[model samples]
Target: MTARRPTAIDIVEVGPRDGLQNDSRHLSTEAKVEMIAKLAGAGLRRIEAASFVNPKRVPQMADAEAVLARVVDLPGVSVSGLVLNGRGFERALAAGLREISFVAVATDTMAARNQGTTARGLVETWAGIAKRAEAEGLFRSVTIAVAFGCPFEGEVPLARVIEIARALAESGADEISLADTIGVATPLAVEERFAALSEAVPGLPMRAHFHNTRNTGYANADAALRSGVTVLDASLGGLGGCPFAPGATGNIATEDLVSMLERDRVATGVSLELLRDATLWLEGEMGRRLPAHGAHVSPWPRVLAA
Candidate 1:
């Protein structure tokens, strides 16, 4: 008997935030607003629109509040922002964002490099953030970066990843995301790790975030879906990388992921043609070709002429 695939999946569009944060060129607040509006028009319901980070650190996201102010009224879209600390979380709340994603690195070395804190320290901070989010009636998601492998520390043990995830869960995180910050995971490894995570936190909503540095991102995404992950994080035009994780590439393309899921008979509630158009616009704005496969190929003709 053939395995049954999920009838539907949620693709969280992280292009406006994750995709643009690492780019050298800074997009204006207006440009950010336009990009997000186009993405929502393409039927993307969940979008990570901005990050409340220090401007000196990530200038691309310096206008998080402005971007959110412009696109918060877009119909049928749930906008979320990334927050790293209490200050960032407060910024997101002030911007009227309903959902927030908090990131914590799996290894102490990465945590120090990314956020200037140790893993334990970040977890402690996250506990407080979680309490505040709950008090304010905000949704919170905890993303464990470098869950598969860390650039500074080479390979991260499964035990360590699970331990961190468990800690975050105990801290009142409503959702969990495992991120392959350096994109070094194999299909089997993704399956095994997600399976382990599922066993550790049964029934918890889990997400998978991957980079395509080594070209295993799509495979890992497939493994993640098969392992019962309900949400997959992707970027438009495959436009992002980690500023800290050297050699890391953009995420799995949103258009490509949606195409694959649609072809596999899974529902993603996204329009491929609209996604393609958005990618083309982004390519033109960036003045270069993007890495997304859907951006390069023409859509197949629905009806062939005899």
Candidate 2:
């Protein structure tokens, strides 16, 4: 008998934020807003608009507020931004953002390297931020970096991910996102970590963010879908990578993932034609070729042939 499939999957388009953060070419604020509107038009309901971090640290996200303000009026869409600390959270709130994300690294070395703090210290800081966001009824979510493996600190233990998950769950985080920050995740590792997290924090809503750096991102996503993870983060044109991860490329393309789901008889509430057009438009705006593997792979050639 064939394996059963899910009826639908939630695709959180992170191109505007995660995908564009490390790009060498700077996109104008207008261009960013246009890209977002196109994605929304392509039927993406949740788009991570920008990061409310130190512009000095990520110059690519300097126009985050400007981008967010421009797209706030898009109906049926929930816009979000990432905030690293209390100050960033305050800035996000002041920018009229209703949803926001915070991040914590599960390993001490990665946490320090990424944020110059210990894992415990990062958790404590996120706890405060989560509480504030919850009290104020703001959309509160936290992403755990290096949940599968860390580039700086190779072979992160599963226990560390669970510890961070449990802490975020207890800290009033509305959602916990597991990021394969460096794209070193395997299907076995994804299943193992997610199962561990589920057992530790029962019923805590979870999301998976993967990078196609090693060509395992789609497989990792497939594993998560089978593991009952509903929220999946993908980018248009697969246009993202972790700057800290040496030799890493962009994320799994949204069109590619959606096309696969559609071919597999799973629903993603996204239109592949629209997604394709948006990616092509994004490639044109970026003024160079983009890294969209699924478009090249033709996941549904047999279906298209018939």
Point to the candidate with the largest TM-score: 1
Tens digits of per-residue lDDT for model 1, 1-306: 433657899999999999999887677788889899888998898999998889998888888888899988788888999989999998988888888999988999988887899998889999999999999988888999999998899999999999999999998977899999888888898888998999999889999999998999998888888888889999998999887656567999999999988998889999999999999999888887888999778676455668
lDDT of 2 by residue, 16-118 (tens): 9998997887899999998999889989988899988789989999888888889976898888888888898998888888888788888999878778898
The parts of candidate 1 lying over 4 Å away from their true place are: 1-3, 245-248
Clashing pairs in 1: none
lDDT agreement with native, every candidate: 0.89, 0.85
Angstrom error of the Cα, residue 287, model 2: value is: 2.1
- What does candidate 2 score on TM? 0.95
Question: Each candidate's TM vs. the true structure?
Answer: 0.97, 0.95
Count clashing residue pairs in model 1. Answer: 0
Stretches > 4 Å off in candidate 2: 1-5, 294-306
Error of 1 at 239 (Å): 0.7
